[model samples]
Target: MTSPSGAPGPGGPDPRRPSLAWLLLPGLGLLVLAAISVSLGAGDFSFSGLLAGTASESWTLLVASRVPRTLALLLAGMSLAVAGLIMQMLVRNRYVEPSTAGTTESATLGILCLMLLAPDTPVIGKMLAATAFAMAGTLLFLGILRRVPLRSPFLVPLIGLVLGGVVHAVTTFFAYRHDMLQSLYAWTTGDFSGVLRGRYELLWIGFGLACAAYLAADRYTVAGMGQQFTTNLGLNHRRLTLMGLLIVSAIASVVVVTAGNIPFLGLIVPNAVSLVLGDNMRRSVPWVALLGGSFVLACDVLGRLVHPPYEIPIGTVVGIVGSALFLLLILRRKGANA
Candidate 1:
C-alpha cells in the first residue's frame, strides 16, 4: 500500500514517488543548462570570470543579458507548457494550444492596435490590450469546439489550424496596410536575444497563473471528463472551463508580448510528458512545466551556437524539432488505434 504522502509500502509503485523521482532528472538538466545559458552568447565570458570576480565585462554581461534571457526562458517555457496542458484538458483536445487556437495571433493583433493608434502605449498597457484580445480569441475557439462534432481527433486541431491561419492572415493584412509588417513579424517568432532587465518582467504573470493551475488541477481534469461527470460532481463546468481559458490567455499574451509567440511548445511538451508520465493532470503538470522549460532553454542555446556570431530564432528551432516529434506522435497514436 502507498502511504499518505505516496510512498510505496511493499509491492506496487508509489504514485507520487515515481513522479517526484522523475523530476530530479530535469533538475539536473536545468542546472547544466543554467550554467551554459549564462556563458554562451556573442561576447566571450566564462565561469572563471564569475569565480575570480575580477572581470568587469563578465559581470556586466551576467547582469545585462544572460541572466535576463535565462530567466525569460524558464518562465516562458514553464508557463506555456502548463497553459498547453490546461487548454488540452479544457477542450478535450490534445492538439489545440495558444499558437494553434488563435490566442497568440489575437494578442499580436491587439499589440498592432496599440502600436498603430497610440504608438506610445506603455508596456503594461500593450499587455493589457493583448491579453484582452487573447481571452476573446480563446472563448471563440472554445465556442467553435462546442458547435462542431468531430469523429476523428485530428479534425478538431485541423480546424484550429485553419482558424489560426485566418486570424494570422487578417493580422498580417492589417499590419501590411499599416506598413508595420516587419515589427509584427518579430512578435510572431520566439527569440530571447532582445531580453534585458526591464523587458521580460511581464512573464511573471504567466508564472503566477501556472501556480494557480496546479491548485485547480483536479477541477480541470474533472471538467475534461465531460459535462455529465462534472455536473454530477457538483462542479460548475462552464466556470471551470472559463478559468482554464483565462489561464491559457494570460500565458499566451504575456509570452507573446514579453518573449514572442512560440508554436508547438504547448502541444509538443504535454503530449511527450503524457507518454512517459501518464494522463493524471495533477501529477503530470509539474513535469510538463519542467520539460517545457528545459526544451526551450536547450533550443535557445542551440540557436545561439548553430551559426556562431549569427543566431537563429528559437521559434524556428523549436518548430523544426516539434514538427518532427509531432509526426512521431501521430504515427504512435495511429499504431495504437490500429
Candidate 2:
C-alpha cells in the first residue's frame, strides 16, 4: 500500500530508501526458525526424515504438534498486532490495544459465559458470542473516549487499562466463585503448546478478521484523523467509528478465543511502526502485519530455546518484554512533548 506525502510515510525505514532488507532479514530468519520449529520436537528433535509423506515417529510428531503450533503462533501474532495498531489509530493514542481496551477481557468473559450458559455449545457459537462481547467492550471504550475529553495524552490508555483491569477482576471473581479458575488460568496464559489439527482451526477466525481489517483500511485511516477531520473529507464519521470498533472487536475476539489474551501486542506493534514509518494506517497496516507476525514468532522461538524440554508461554514473555518497550516509547514521547 502507498503512503501519504508526510514524513517518510509507512513503507519502511525510509521512503526513498525503503530498505525492507532489515525487516526481510529478520522475517526470513524467523521463517527458517519456524520451519525448524515445526520439524523439531521433544520426542525426536529431527527434521531430516520429514521431507516427503514418509512416515517416522518424528514426522508424526512434527505434523501433529509442531506444524499446527507454528501456524497458531503466526496467526495469533499477526492478528493481535493489527488489532493493536487499529485501536491506537482510532483512539489517537499510542498505548492503546485490545488488552487495554477491555476487548480481550470481554472476550474471556464471553467464553466463561458460554461455558456456564451452554456447556455443550459448538465452537462457532462460542466464537460468535466472544465476538459480540468484544465488540461491546470496544464500543464502550469508544463511548468513554467520546465522553471524556482527555487533555493529557496518557489518560486515554490509562483509562482503557483501568477498564481492562476491572473487567479482568470481574472475570477472575467469577472464575473463582464457579471453581473454574483452573480453566480460566489455562485460557488466559497464551501458550501454543497444545495446538493440534482440530483444536487449531479456531485461529483461522483471527486470520479472517485480519483480512476484514485490511479491507476497511481506508475508513480506519480517516477515522484516526478525528471525527471532524473525517467529516470534512466527506466521510461518515459514525459509520467509520462503528466500522473501526467492529474491526477491533472482531480481531480481539478471535485472538482471545484462539490463543488466550496476549497483552501489549496491539499496543506495541502499531506504535513501533508509527515511529519508524509514520501513522499512515494504509502503510502501517501491512508493516504492523509483518512486524507483529515476526515479533510473536521470534518470541515463540525464544520461549522454546530458553527452556529446552519445557516451554514458556508467549503471553508472559510479551507482557514482560512489551511493557518495557512501551514504557520507553511513552517516555520518549513525553520528552519530545516537553
Q: Across residues 107-183, which tens digit of lDDT does each residue of candidate 2 receive?
A: 88889999988989887888889889888887888788779967776787788888888988998998999999998
* C-alpha RMSD (angstroms) for model 2: 3.7
Overall lDDT per candidate, in order of appearance: 0.84, 0.77
lDDT tens digits, residue span 1-338, model 1: 22221111123433444655666989899879978988888887988878898889989989988899999999999999999888887777777678878889889988998999999889889888998899898788778867987767777678788778888899999899999988998999998889999899999999999999999888887786777788999999989988888889888999998878888999899887866655567887888999899999999889989989888999899999888887887777777667
Give the Cα-based TM-score of candidate 1 against the true structure: 0.93
Compute the lDDT for candidate 1: 0.84
- TM-scores across all candidates? 0.93, 0.91
RMSD of each: 5.1, 3.7
Q: Which ranges of candidate 1 are over 4 A from the true structure? A: 1-21
The number of clashing residue pairs in model 2 is 1
